[model samples]
Target: MNKNSKNLLRFAGIFGLIGAILGAHMAGSGSYAFRAVHAHILVVGWLTLFGWAVFYKIFQTTETVLTKLHVWSAIIGSIGLTVGMWLYMVKPFNLPEGVTLFIYIGGGVALLLSFLLFFLLTLFIKEKK
Candidate 1:
C-alpha cells in the first residue's frame, strides 16, 4: 500500500522464509537448540520487527526520534541479518567466525534500539484510549 507497508510485507516474507527453513530442519526431529539462532533471526529479526512496522503504519504511530530509530534500526538490522545468513549458508567465500557474529550484531543492535525507543516513546505518547 505504502512504502512502510511494503517494507513490512517484505520483512515478513523474509521471516517466513527463515521459519520454513527451520521448520524443514525440525521436520526430521531436529533439536530446537540447533535452530535457536534461526528462531531469533526469524521471530525478532523478521516477524516481530515486520509486525511492529505494520502496526506503526496502521496506527500512524508517532515518535520523532523513536520513529526514525525504528526505521533505521530495522533496516540496518535486516541488512546485517542478511549478510550473516548469507555467510552462514555460503561459507565458501571465506569468512571468520568473529565477522559472522559481528554481522548478527547489526540485527541485534537494530532490534535493541527499536525496542528501547518504543519503550521510551510509549511513555510520552498519548494512548489511543
Candidate 2:
C-alpha cells in the first residue's frame, strides 16, 4: 500500500473506533444527544477516509502536491469538523459561539476542497494498458 493509503487507513480506523465507542456510550446511557456527532464521525471521518485510502491503494497515483494537500485537508477537516461539532453542540469548555462556529465552517470548507481535489484526481488517472 502507498504511504498515503496507510496514513488514511489508520485515521479511518481511529474514527471508526471513536464512532463505535460513542455509539456504545449513547446506547448504554440511553441518550441520543451524540447522534449527529456519532453519525458524522462514522460517515465523514471513517467511511470517507476509508474510501480515499482504498482509492490510493488501488490507483497508481503519484504523490504530488495535490495529493498531499488532499490528504492533510481530509485529516484536518475530519478532526476539525467533529471536534467543532462537539464544542458547538455540547457547549463544553464554555467556548465562544463564534469560535466554535468558525471552526465548524472552516472544517467543512476544507473537507469540501478535499472532495473537489479528489474529483480532479480521478480525471488524471492513467490507463493501465
Candidate 3:
C-alpha cells in the first residue's frame, strides 16, 4: 500500500483501539468522566487523519515535506490532546492541573495549524484529469 493508504489504515487502527478502551472504561466505571477525551481521539485522531489520508490519495499528492509535517503534527496533537485530557480528567499520573491543561490546549493549536497547512496544500493542487 502507498503511504497515504497506510496513514489512513493506521488512523483507523487507532480508532479501533480507542473505541475498545472507551468501551471497557465505560463498562467498568459506568461513568462518562473521560468522554470528552474519548471523543477527541475518535474525531481528530481517527476521523480527521483518515479524511486527510483519503484526500491525499485521491488527489495524488506526493509524499512531500508538507505532508510529512501534517502527519507528524497530527500524530503529536492527537496523542497529546488525548493523553492530556486523560490526565486532566483521570488524574492517574498525578500531573499538575495546569500542565495538563497546557498540553490539551497546545495540542489543539498544533492540530489547527496542521489543518491550515493541509488547506493551503489543497489550494495548490491541480485536478488529476
Candidate 4:
C-alpha cells in the first residue's frame, strides 16, 4: 500500500479503537452523546479524509502543498478532538469547559478545510490524454 493508503488504514484502526471504547462505555453509562461525537470524528473526520487521500493517490492525482496540509491537519486535528471528547464528554477532566470547546471547534475547522480541499481537488483534474 502507498503512504496514503497506509494512512487510511491507520486512521481506520484508530477509529475502530475509539468505537470499541465508546461501545464499552455506552454499555454502562447508557449515554450516547459521547459515542455519537466519537463516531463522527473517526468515521467522518478520519476515515472519510483518509479515504479521499488514498483515492487521490491511487488515481495518480496531483495535489498542492495546501491540499497536503489540509489532509494532515484534518487527521491530526481529528485526533485532538477525539481526545477532547473522551476527556470532556466521555469523562470529566481538569480542563475548563471553555478550553474544551476551543479544542473541539478548532478540530472541526481543520476537518472543514480537509473537505474543502477534497472538493476543490475533484474539480480540477487532468483530462485523460
Using TM-score, give the best candidate's number: 2
Q: Whole-model lDDT for model 1 versus the true structure?
A: 0.66
Model 1 stretches with alpha carbons more than 4 Å out = 26-34, 62-65, 78-94, 124-129
Clashing pairs in 3: none
Q: What's the lDDT of the predicted structure labeled candidate 2?
A: 0.93
Candidate 2 matches the true fold with a TM-score of 0.96
For candidate 3, write residues 1-129 as lDDT tens digits. Answer: 558658766975787688678968887999887788778777877788788777776676677888788777877777787787788888988888899999888888888888888887887776555
Question: What's every prediction's RMSD, in angstroms?
Answer: 3.8, 1.2, 1.9, 3.0
lDDT per residue, candidate 1, 30-57, as tens digits?
Answer: 5554365566667765777677666665
Best by lDDT: 2
The 10-residue segment with the lowest total lDDT in model 2:
120-129
User: Where does the lowest 10-residue lDDT sum fall in candidate 3?
Assistant: 1-10
Positional deviation of 67 in candidate 1, in angstroms?
Answer: 1.8
* C-alpha TM-score for every candidate: 0.66, 0.96, 0.85, 0.75
Model 1, 111: alpha-carbon shift in Å? 2.0
Model 2 error, position 20 (Å): 0.2
Query: In what order do the candidates fall by lDDT, top score first?
Result: 2, 3, 4, 1
Which of 1 and 2 is ahead in TM-score? 2
Query: Which whole-number lDDT from 0 to 100 does residue 32 have in model 2?
Result: 91
